[model samples]
Target: MGPGPKVKCPPRLAPCGLRLVQVRFPTGLTSEEYVKQEAWRFARLERCPFHPEGGCGLARHGTYARVSPPGCLIARWWCPTARTSISLLPDFMCSRLTGTLAEVEAVVAAADAAPTREVASEVLRPDVELPGALRWLRRRTRLVHAGLAAAIGLLPGLLARCEPTITSVRSALGAEVALVRLRAELVPHLAALPPPLGFGPRPAQRRSSLTALQQESGTDPPSGTR
Candidate 1:
């Protein structure tokens, strides 16, 4: 069948225009429970976040659903002056990625604990083919490494002394819930970093998978792949 036609991704909703505000949820809060109780209504902005001087006409913009946590609604606010919208995202929900932060952490933790990316893929995602699984795992690992790097730069007093590695981070902070702890610590500065950790915009998508895979392994790209 030669090569299949490329699939088109749906247009992102206001890529640069949307900002995120992290909100904490009570323990054991499920997506279903969140929707049923109309939890989105609870997230409120007293004044215009963009224009705190007073009079920017910030209004409640309704809610948006998340794909991972089915039925969960994120509350939104619109600013007329800035022409941007802010979404109140619950901390449990991963910012840019689909699944929750806990799920993302599990994937990365498993990969880090394993001997190699190849080994980790086989153990953590046996259902997926090796190449596909590596790509999936690589994405999470790269994003997390980026987030950790940002964390270190932002909190130099606490983290600057430590080496820039996940193991070092886990050792410096809590082992099991390092990502969760980092998220809470980065709450004030979330706007500067990108998601799964913060609300900052994601970097541009790479065009070449082979290059990404090569970069992930820190090896020269194999001949004949490109």
Candidate 2:
């Protein structure tokens, strides 16, 4: 849905470049109509992250429309050297997830609070199926746990107490905004780092799971936007 040579990039925006300049969007605006009016306002960009020639070539290439969930427009910045446009995405949504960050957080909380998917569903996601919600939660936990561990230091076997993830997850449970705060601190920074880390078997006994997932998904790593 952004720029680059990949077939998935949208057809609009002149179809060029791989690099983009990202700008943060504030919350409150919702729906396609709202997005259309606001997307253009974030069009301002600067030096390209992918260009080797050292030029602030990011320009107001155009806007792409999105429907579903929040339904908002995604504005793109064109980078000639990268040969594509970069869509400015909101912090509230993951680049790949179909649901909003709140939705994702809801599911994660549900999963953590309940013993079974059915139980969690009954408590929160009564409208959705278990398989879908559980899978999404697993993926997010995988990324967040591993990514955070990678971004910061964690203790090794026997001394692995106080890992950043444990604090973050506990924080999430206590506060509604905790998950969002964690995502803000982690996702964007981790996105640039491909090949997620495998933290190892157990923070207290062996290699953490973060290290394990990295090894498993190493062949094809996340683009970070996910």
lDDT of each: 0.67, 0.46
Most accurate candidate by TM-score:
1
lDDT of 2 by residue, 1-226 (tens): 2333322223443434343334444343443434566644555545444543344344566665543344455666666544655655565544444445555555555565578756765566456566544444555555455544554442233223335453455443455534344444554553442112221221232345444333333211123321
The number of the candidate with the highest lDDT is 1
For every model shown, what is its TM-score relative to the native structure? 0.72, 0.55
Candidate 1 residue-wise lDDT at 194: 67
Which residues of candidate 1, in runs, are more than 4 Å off?
1-38, 165-167, 203-226
lDDT of 1 at 222: 12
lDDT (C-alpha) at residue 24 in model 1:
41
True-vs-predicted CA distance for residue 135, candidate 2, Å: 3.0
Error at 72, model 1, angstroms = 1.7
